[model samples]
Target: MGYMPTEMELIELGQNINMNLGGRVDFEDFVELMAPKLLAETAGMIGVKELKDAFKEFDMDGDGEITTEELRQAMNKLMGEHMSRREIDAIVKEADDNGDGTVDFEEFVRMMSR
Candidate 1:
């Protein structure tokens, strides 16, 4: 799915357009006001295939889920950054929606989408 702007984002966009165009916004004006924000948000987004690839990379053992250990190892190998065990645990905890001590594909997607 594409970037879903929040209600607050719409409100702010409207306010910005109003401020710049004196309460009148043509299609061009709206596009001009919205394009930058949309581009910035999408720039950070990975496509489904890319996300799946990333998940696979972290799931090192081909187990279809990413445990804290797997994540830590992936981080160390991929990013070359040695994170602490507590830090790794915290990352898994944040994305483990079912509190299962592991992150499955759906949970990983939800975490990344945020």
Candidate 2:
């Protein structure tokens, strides 16, 4: 197996993607705001279809609206393959506000929202 990645690995990977996106947000809106970064992050690892597929988890009420937990699960699923459980936990804990032992949807969206 390949060597496990460190905390800096994920952080650095995200930073790299942000840099590769090559511009700042032009709009002040949330959807428009994070569009670029989100696309960039999901480009190689996740994608539009994959996001839509994963979004199912976010629809907590099943009213077609995405919640925070669903979002977190999507992200965890995306990058989880690239890192070890310990590393994933450390990275996730930084964003898990409820301390529920795992990331919830809202907290996840908030983290990505940052």
Top candidate on TM-score is 1
Using all chains and alpha carbons, the TM-scores for the candidates as numbered come to 0.61, 0.33
Query: Could you say which candidate leads in lDDT?
Result: 1
Question: Can you write out model 1's per-residue Cα lDDT over 11-101, one digit (the tens) per residue?
Answer: 9987887787888888887756765565455434667677789989999999999999999999999999899999999999999978999
Clashing pairs in 1: none
Residue 43's lDDT within candidate 2 is 43
Reference-based TM-score, model 1: 0.61
Positional deviation of 30 in candidate 2, in angstroms? 21
Candidate 1 Cα RMSD (Å): 10.4
Error of 2 at 93 (Å): 0.7
lDDT of 1 at 94: 94
Model 2: residue 60 alpha-carbon error in angstroms? 12
Tell me how candidate 1 scores on lDDT: 0.82
All models: lDDT? 0.82, 0.51
Counting clashing residue pairs in each candidate, in order, gives 0, 5
